[model samples]
Target: MVIRSRRLSKDNTYYALKQKIIDSELEPNQAVNEENLAALLGVSRTPLREAIQRLENEDFLVRQPNGRLRVASVTIKEVEEVFLIRSMLEGYIARSAAKHATDKDILHLTTMMERIKHSFQLGDKQDFVSYGFEFHDYLSEISELRTFEKVLNQLRDHSLRYCRYVSMHGDWNTQADEEHNYILQMIADKNEDGAEKAMRDHILSSLSTALARIKGMEENEIDHIGP
Candidate 1:
């Protein structure tokens, strides 16, 4: 494949590679072949190596003792850790949203949630997952706090790996829609405590659901291994 590296400076390359990891194109636990990725990105090995190193430092990639780079797996334990932190950060943001969200912002959020709801009803799993993620992101935007925004983005980036593999095929999207809408209403009404609880519960609920799914898959894998 011809890789186009145009318009990519150092910062862009690093983030692009980072996003690719999140997108699962460069899937979890997969090796990172520097020479090939450099060719693929149409850049020299130097910039690619730099990006890889950055990803490594960020815990997004792991350099094996043999000097091979691998995508970091999102383990069940890691998922719990990430969401625990995210719940706290976003719980505060939701409280802030309740205190600060304007009618216009709530209206926009309602519209976006409805659009995602429609996509879910239409059985567009990819769209459902995408919208689910974007919905939380929009809520962070509602907080109007730059620090929260940055931290939230990092949290989102960490969770996004599982998102690519996350099945949006269930009725979960509808549940998510209901949850987000409730959160939005609380924020609009400036019910700070309600908003915080709703958002925190939502995060915990989803994480539980995801963990269950991962556990089920693991069980299936073990069953297969036995045969």
Candidate 2:
């Protein structure tokens, strides 16, 4: 029982730290103080070190030249790599969804679309993104490819940091909504090719905008890689 409790505590510490990095609460390239974090989390150094090691293994944190751990910073190379992979995989998943989705699945996606639109109207960017994830998850689930869904879940989370970055600097929400509408329409029509194309186009377009904004920031001597 003691062993199990320690393991649970370690797992909780891992996820909490991972969430802080993912949500950009910790900020990219921000130095991590192990002692300070241990105090903040109300955990001892042992469990905190274990959790930090796990996050480092997962590429969410990196060791700097000074041997300090910092959240991994975004770069043009990473943006290109992540979006390229996501476009291909998500496109395939969208195609599979169109081919296999039932009436209920279609209705569920439609309802999610409405919720996303409402969120946008209310300027609730977080809710809009959350509902969009729900829509994607449902589509992937209906595709009946468990392995693909697992890969996509990680890819989407990493890509979301960039998505939120774009939203902060541009009017990407409406563009994404328009693209989503096209993808959803294709899925509803069971047009596998069209659905795949729409999904790929959406991802590539998003990548283009994010890259442009990053370039602009670099030119202005401001690195916008953090929240």
Candidate 3:
């Protein structure tokens, strides 16, 4: 029981730290103080160190030359790469879903779309983002492609980080809504090619938006540092 408890503690610590990084509560490249973090997370050094090691392995944390740790920085290249991979994986999944989805799946997705739209209308960006993820996840679930789903899950946290940045700095307006609706329509129509293309286009559009925001952020930082 003691060993099991310790394992649970480590797992909890890892997830808590990961959530902070994903949510940008621990901003990119922010320095990590072991003692302070251990205290803040209400865990001992052993579990905290275990968590940090795991994050480092996942590329969510970086160890500096001086042995300090910091949250991984979000880069334009990383964003592009992640989104490109997501586009391929999700596009395939969307195609599969269109081929295999039942009527109940279609109804569930339509309901989720309504909730997403309502969240946007109410200016609830957080809920809007959450619902958007759920919408995609459900489609992936219905695809019945467990391997694709597993791989996409690995990228989801990183995708969410960039998505949050975009949501905070840009608008989630009619274009995004239209893109989602179009994807859903293709799925409902059981148009496999259309579903794949629509999903790919939607993801690539997001890449464009994220790239713009990231470039703007870089330029702003440079301006701030200039003479």
Model 3 Cα lDDT, one tens digit per residue, 1-227: 99999999999999999988887888889998899889878999999999999999989999999999888999999999999999999999999999999999999999999998998889887678889899999999999999999999999988998788678776776777788899999999999999999999999998998898889989999999998
Top candidate on TM-score is 3
Two-way TM-score contest, 2 vs 3, winner: 3
TM-score of each: 0.88, 0.90, 0.96
- Error of model 1, residue 57, in angstroms: 1.2
Candidate models: Cα lDDT each: 0.79, 0.84, 0.91
Candidate 1 lDDT over 1-227, as tens digits, reads 12445335666779888888877778778887888788767777777778888888889999899988788986899888888888888899999888888888888888888878787788877677788777778778878878988977777888766655556323454576688778888888899999999999988887887788777777877999996
Candidate 2, residue 159: Cα displacement in angstroms equals 1.2
Clashes of 2: 0
Clashing residue pairs in candidate 2 (N, C-alpha, C atoms within 3 angstroms): none
lDDT of 1 at 127: 72
Judging by TM-score, tell me the better candidate of 1 and 2: 2
Residue 186's lDDT in candidate 2: 98
Per-residue error (Å), model 1, residue 149: 3.1
